[model samples]
Target: MSLLTHSRQRTAPSNTPPSRGGGRRTGRRAGAARKQFTAWLFLVPTLLVFGLFAWWPIVRSLLLGFQRTNLVDPAVWVGLDNFRALLDDPLLGTAVGNTLLFVGLGILIGFPAPLVLAAVVTTVRRGAGIYRFLVYLPVVIPPVVAILLWKWFYDPGSGLFNNALGLIGLGPFSWLESPDTAMLSLVLEATWAGMGGAVLIYLAAMAGIPAELYEAAEVDGAGIRRRIRHVMLPQLRSVIGLLLLVQLIGTIQVFTEPYVFTGGGPENATLTVLLLIFRYAFQDGEYGQAAALSFLMVLALALLSAVYLRATRSWSRS
Candidate 1:
């Protein structure tokens, strides 16, 4: 009987305690779950605040595009009327053209100025920090304050520019008064104000470029111009491309200069897309139209970014 019972004990399944390792693994998994839950608990407030302020506003704006309301009154659903009205308005065309002109001017003048400045600064061994500080000084100034300072500098009568030009018998020209010069004046001030950031970015990018590439180019009989063309430009391509896109987007949405400097005057010469949107909402109380216009601008910007990225993908990869 004892022999038979021993055989049965060996053959039959017996209830065994879970291995210590299995218990430890379960405890570890529970601990990890608790840690993850704690992390999410900490993130909840930030997510709530972001949703309340940022995401809610975006969603509300999208809804507002389809409704007509002065924000005090009841919102009336208007469907596509707001969008249609935008297309019908003559001012839209003018605003678009002006925006395009600003962008073009920015590309031609503003885009290259910082690059040139950075390149020149890179060659200087002494007082380089002072030059950088001076270049970046305008950026630290408040936008309105900087614009105001430039306004004084651009004063038609006894202005700094005119006074300097008078010595050479050149220009006591209307810097911001005439339509022909008003947009250009805005561009000049904008470029000066914005170039600081771009210069710093370019300087940082230049610093990352290996000195060996330049040395190799020089070894291959590449002079200054050739070295820059074959060595520097190729290396900085990605940074240059990114900054170009950012500048393009910022210039398209320009408002402050035209608003403060000219108030879209000199026969609406400097009116930009953002300024026009402002006029619609605040001036005309056309909130729906403004929202519609804003929605369209968002779409256009998104499309532009997508297209630009798609087009530049190959260049970036290569």
Candidate 2:
């Protein structure tokens, strides 16, 4: 009887149910929910700030784009009349063209500069930090200071640029005087001032690249040029594309430099789209036209952003 009882006890399973595992899982889910709620609570203030300050203003401006208003009277519905006038305005066309030119020239001059500087820094064996600091120095300077310095440098008769050109027997060129050179001078100044940020970004990107890749390339008898072409360039393609898009958008809205330096003078050679919008709204008191122009600028930027997003999506898929 004792042997039979022992055998029966051995055959029976443990009393604890399998559902305990499910209970543990439920507990974990509850804990996760609590953490998530806490995180959201922390994010609420940031979201509220963005909504109130950034999003609300954007919404108001978009609504204002459709209405006509001034300091004295309340806004009235204008429908598409403002848009029609904007399209018909000869000055608008000129502003658009000049804005496009500024963006293009700025990118052409500015984009590669930082990349080159970053590449050089990466290759240097010594004093790289000093070089970076020197390059970044101008970026931290106030815009007013930078613009004033460039203005002094570009002075036709007594500027440093003219002096340097004279050493090589070149003419005392009127940089800001002529319409052709005015925009170019702006491009040069912008490039000089803006290259530091690009350099920093590119340097960071380069630092993220694995050293093993370069070491392997070196072991395979690859030279610097070959490695740059096959490895570095391919890795930087996405970064370069992103930077190009950002630069295009920023350059299109350029105002401060041109406003301070050129005042949209010399036959409006340096007048950007934003400057024209400002002149309309404040100087001329043409709020309708200004709103219309602002809306058009927004449309252009949206289109550019859309195209860039599509290209980025396609690249990611590939």
For model 1, residues 1-318, the per-residue Cα lDDT tens digits are 699998998999769876799889999999999999999999999999999999998789889899999999899999999999999999999999999999999999999999999999999999999999999999999999999999999998978999999999988899899999999999999999999999999999999999999998899999999988888888888988999999999999999999999999889999889999999999999999998999899999999999999999879767
List the pairs of residues colliding in candidate 1. Answer: none
Query: What would the TM-scores of all predictions be?
Result: 0.95, 0.86
Error of 2 at 67 (Å): 1.8
Scored by TM-score, the top model is 1
Query: Could you say which candidate leads in lDDT?
Result: 1
What lDDT would each prediction earn against the true structure?
0.94, 0.87
lDDT of candidate 1? 0.94
Model 1 poorest 10 in a row by lDDT? 10-19
RMSD in Å for candidate 2, one decimal? 5.9
Instruction: Give the Cα error of residue 239 in candidate 2, in Å.
Output: 1.3
Worst 10 residues of 2 by lDDT: 309-318
